[model samples]
Target: MESHLLEVLVCPLCKSKLDHNREQQQLVCKADQLAFPIRDGIPLMLQSEAISLSSSET
Candidate 1:
């Protein structure tokens, strides 16, 4: 992911900062406990497309 793009991207639900998980190619929102997937270098920021993080993940 591009650093510039990552800096501007935020969680679509909570509008919070996201941490990049390079291995999974996802943007993780710790506050919202959601993971937004990145496909073909584009982030799918839609809430419906996000995966909820488990309690153990937090």
Candidate 2:
């Protein structure tokens, strides 16, 4: 993901800052316990598309 875009993107559910997980290619919202997937370099920011983070992972 581009640094500029990463800087501005937030969680759709909670409006919280996201942490980019480069290995998984996802933007994680720790506050909301969600992970937004990045597909083909584009972020899927929709709440419906977000993956719920496991308790152990959170």
Candidate 3:
């Protein structure tokens, strides 16, 4: 993702900053305990697409 685009992208639910998880290729919002998937170079920002984070991650 482009730096400018990533800068503007935030967790849809909490509107919080996201951590770029390069290995998983996802945008993680620790505050929201959600990880938005990045598939085929596209970020799936939909809430339904997010995976719940483990309690240890929060």
Per-candidate local distance difference test: 0.89, 0.90, 0.90
lDDT of 3 by residue, 1-58 (tens): 7778889999999899998888888999989889999999899999999999997864
Could you tell me which residue pairs clash in candidate 1? none
Candidate 2 regions exceeding 4 Å error are none
lDDT of 1 by residue, 1-58 (tens): 9899888988888889999999988899999889998999989988889999997875
| Model 1, position 26: C-alpha lDDT score | 88
**Candidate 2: tens digits of C-alpha lDDT, residues 13-36:** 888899999999999999988999
- On lDDT, the leading prediction is 2
Off by over 4 Å in 3: none
- Candidate 2 C-alpha error for residue 17, in Å: 0.4
Stretches of candidate 1 exceeding 4 Å from the true structure: none
Candidate 3 global CA lDDT score: 0.90
Candidate 3, residue 57: lDDT: 62
- Sort by TM-score, best first: what order? 2, 1, 3
Instruction: Spell out the clash pairs found in candidate 3.
Output: none
Which candidate has the highest TM-score of all? Answer: 2
